[model samples]
Target: MRLIIAGLFALAVMLSPAAYAVQPDEIMADPVKEARARDLSRELRCMVCQNQSIDDSEAPLARDLRLLVRERIAAGDSDSQVIDFLVARYGEFVLLKPRFERQTWLLWLLTPLALAGGGLALWMHGRRRPKSAPGEDGSEAILSAAEEARLQRLMAAEPPPESPS
Candidate 1:
């Protein structure tokens, strides 16, 4: 009985994905167009899925995008031209590998600039931090033996209860 229940559970789980499945409307009129549609759909990101390509996604927008690709292919648009058209309609964010250009130059440069800026900030912070030893201005750390003991005790203090949980 347990084995039968387990088999039924596995089948249910496998078939659960068929609930919001792709429909017939997503197909192209011609098989040749359908092949192109499938290829293009794999390249095109699904706006709704945000990560999965249109071909892998079962979303309505993905289906529409698939149909749009089929229509474009049937109209005899070259692959590059079709991609360019979509890029023009949607921003470079749609393409998995965005074309590097004047418009997207800032996007390409921003991460490196941010990293350099952060490194600069960290360098500046380290420079500005008060030196602990008698190195920066030759002022020796004059923590008395008692004060050092007290500081050590404070540092070794146990953590309090984490009330947020």
Candidate 2:
């Protein structure tokens, strides 16, 4: 049915990868340079949309960044040079994935360090736990003499329940 076809089309659009936000006017005439610009845009963050790559962000700042990338590429700057220029201009926050450096060592190492610390603490906790000896019912808890006597007395004092007539 037409309804089902329309629904399928809608679902396909929704499931597809996000469309790039670059406008027609922003595209460079040279395909090679444009492609390079696009690749660089995808690596740079949209300052306005902090989590989104400039290539995928529709923000005015993202558009400017895309244009800047194209301008840099046209000026014969290499990818790394363009990236370094942007970093110098906007700080490291402009990069979608920051490079590992002495300044960023803590940011890059914190997660693995925390995970290792947690694993070590869990291992120590497991080792420190007293192990129960296996018995007929799986684990035997050894009761003290007074506790055993108390249990015996309590069991002996409990009356047997009468069976239902």
Candidate 3:
């Protein structure tokens, strides 16, 4: 059926690896430099697209970033130097994976800290909960001895039910 074929095509597109955005004109004559450029491009974020790397985005800003990386490579800048230049220009946000330093310590540790807090809360909640009696199916009201006595008194005050002959 047409629907089945369309679904299969959609699935194939989704399962495919990320597409490369580097055009033919952007490739360098030297394979080594080109490889380095590609590696750096993969590490750089596409400012316009926000989610994809420069190497995998089709946005104009991503294209510019790709070209800039190639230019730095051609100019004999070391990988570290190129990365430093980008960091200086775009701040640390340009890096896909930020360094674990004092400035970013909260970002790195927030999840674990929250998870530990949640676990402690759950444990404390369980500890403080009232224990249900055996065979109590959780639907009946749980009452203390004094409250049960009061309920019995109230029931005795009511008239007895009349039975049909």
Candidate 4:
């Protein structure tokens, strides 16, 4: 009885993920239609699950997305048309692969531009720095001999160091 119960528990755990909403029977029988549906599902958002793909999401919204995709495929809508319809209805946020033109051009280019800008800024800043030296003398190389003599006199006039004893 204990072993049977344990086996049943394991089986339920294994099958639980399949129960998340979409059933295999919902997919079209034609292989070409099925492939298109799969591709669209991967691109469409699970409106309920938000971050999950329609194909993998168990949300009611994901199921609706799946059904909508199949219906569009059946209605002779081409892939781009169906995607356009969804984008029109749901905004570009629904697309897993956002288009690169116009408003979204920044999304594709901003990071590299920022990195290159930052690299150039860093390179310029580094170029302005004097090469590493043993002491602070290198930083003060512009000072005249008179300035150094005055600074040395100031240092020499300081009180004697106190003993720690």
Best by lDDT: 2
Give me the displacement of residue 24 in model 4, in angstroms: 2.7
With candidate 4 superimposed using the best TM-score fit, by how many Å does residue 81's alpha carbon deviate from the native?
A: 0.9
Clashes of each: 0, 0, 0, 0
lDDT for each residue of candidate 3 in 1-165, tens digit (9 for 90 to 100): 999999999888666534448877889999999999999998988888887888988887888898999999999999999999999999999999887989999999999999999999999999999987744765777788999999999999999989999
Indicate the residue-level lDDT of 136 in model 1. 48
Error (Å) of candidate 4 at residue 104 is 1.0
Which candidate number has the best TM-score?
A: 2
RMSD to the hidden true structure, all candidates: 10.9, 4.8, 6.4, 5.3
Native-vs-model 3 lDDT? Answer: 0.89
Tens digit of lDDT per residue, candidate 1, span 1-165?
Answer: 999999999889667633333456767668877777677766788788788777777788877776777778888998887788888888676676667899888888999999999999999999999767654467666788999999889878967667885
lDDT score for candidate 1 against the true structure: 0.76
Candidate 1: lDDT of 96?
A: 64
What TM-score would you give candidate 2 relative to the actual structure? Answer: 0.75
TM-scores of all models? 0.52, 0.75, 0.68, 0.68
The total of clashing pairs for model 4 equals 0
- Inter-residue clash pairs, candidate 4: none
Per-residue lDDT tens digits of candidate 2, residues 68-158?
A: 8988898999999999999999999999999999999999999999999999999999999887554645667788899999999998999
